[model samples]
Target: MLGKLKDLLFSASEADARAADHDDVAVAAAAVMVETATLDGTFDEDERASILGLLQRRFQLSDADARELLAEAEAEQQDTNELYAFTRAIKDHFDHDQRVEMVEMLWEVVYADGVAHDFETNLMRRVCGLLYVEDAESGAARKRVLDRLGLSS
Candidate 1:
């Protein structure tokens, strides 16, 4: 009976580890989005809504879940010392095109308030490089976002 109990405990510990890993991925992704939004030094309401909407749509999460995740992400981002903790998880989990899409989404957030800041642009460039997205692709994505926002180059 003791041996069986030990095995059960081991199995539960493995499950907990897996859950932690999954949470890490979700938190990392959320952190990336949150950090990108804060890059402009103006986390405006429109940008927040855009980020929440994207999270809800992408993760198939309800509004409450998305908000909770965003809150958790904000905390994690504040605690982290660098961007790699978030970018690495995204690079490992997402494909090239998906990363490009992420860049596009970030640009959308930057433009959501009807103004694009230099810091936001710089952050997007750095993030694109980290995500292994080519410069041309990143540029193209930015252009597409700008076009959608009806913003002139």
Candidate 2:
């Protein structure tokens, strides 16, 4: 599974990306969460927990369901070539607030390690634009997460 994710996120082709449709919105969103968690090259326990918590709350799932979604997301993320397919599905299926909430989820993953790296923030920026999320909203979401985590922005 680790190797699959690395190959999907770190290396893939347009053909692989097009096949990303295998993932539904929840799975796609989970994939993006997984992507952010692994982007810093750690994939630490903290980030994993954050992703699980977010999936649970966002989808209102039981622990088992949440874990299943995460696993499915890991597989989906690993099978894809790009993030665009997921983002497009999300943008098409969800409303503006839901999209903003996703950005918030991404920020939570970014800060899961207690420190948001340059690459993480850069990924957040790109994802915000791809999802058509306004910069101000993304910043607000970041602040909300920081406040919840008791971290100073």
Candidate 3:
């Protein structure tokens, strides 16, 4: 059992390292946002713009750069299955607060349409666990996003 776990972590770590370059990081992060936006099978303009805005602000990228990253991520997401790849990339680079912020950005995307779907919520839970964020921290991140959007839940 321990050997299996070690092998899994080692593989994940190796994959993470391979995708650790700057552009790859942006693509990986944007892929996560893409996953969140498409969770409900209803990806829309609002969600797309929300993701663009988050990437712009979080990474301080220009509009073109953000759009480029978004396009790459959209393509990458279509080919990707599980989010473990993205989360592993994130876990290798981003610290606790950054992961918490990723959760918050995900919540913003989930609520961009003014309603949270069941799949969106479930994806957030799973991503938070993968990112090693505590439930309380993710809850706090959700609250912060809700407050920013003048929403309550």
TM-score of each: 0.83, 0.83, 0.86
Which numbered prediction scores highest in lDDT against the true structure? 3
Task: Identify the superior model by TM-score, candidate 1 or candidate 3.
Answer: 3
Cα deviation at 146, candidate 2, in Å, is 0.4
TM-score of 1: 0.83
Error of 3 at 97 (Å): 0.9
Candidate 3 residue spans exceeding 4 A from truth? 1-20
Q: Sorted by TM-score, highest first, which candidate order results? A: 3, 2, 1
Ordered list by lDDT, greatest first: 3, 2, 1
Report per-prediction Cα RMSD to one decimal: 2.8, 11.4, 8.6
Tens-digit lDDT string for candidate 2 (21-60):
4338889899999988888888988998999999889978
Clashing pairs in 1: none
Sliding window of 10 residues with minimal summed lDDT for model 2? 14-23
lDDT of 2: 0.89
Candidate 1 local lDDT, 79-114, one digit each (tens): 985898788887887778888887787777778888
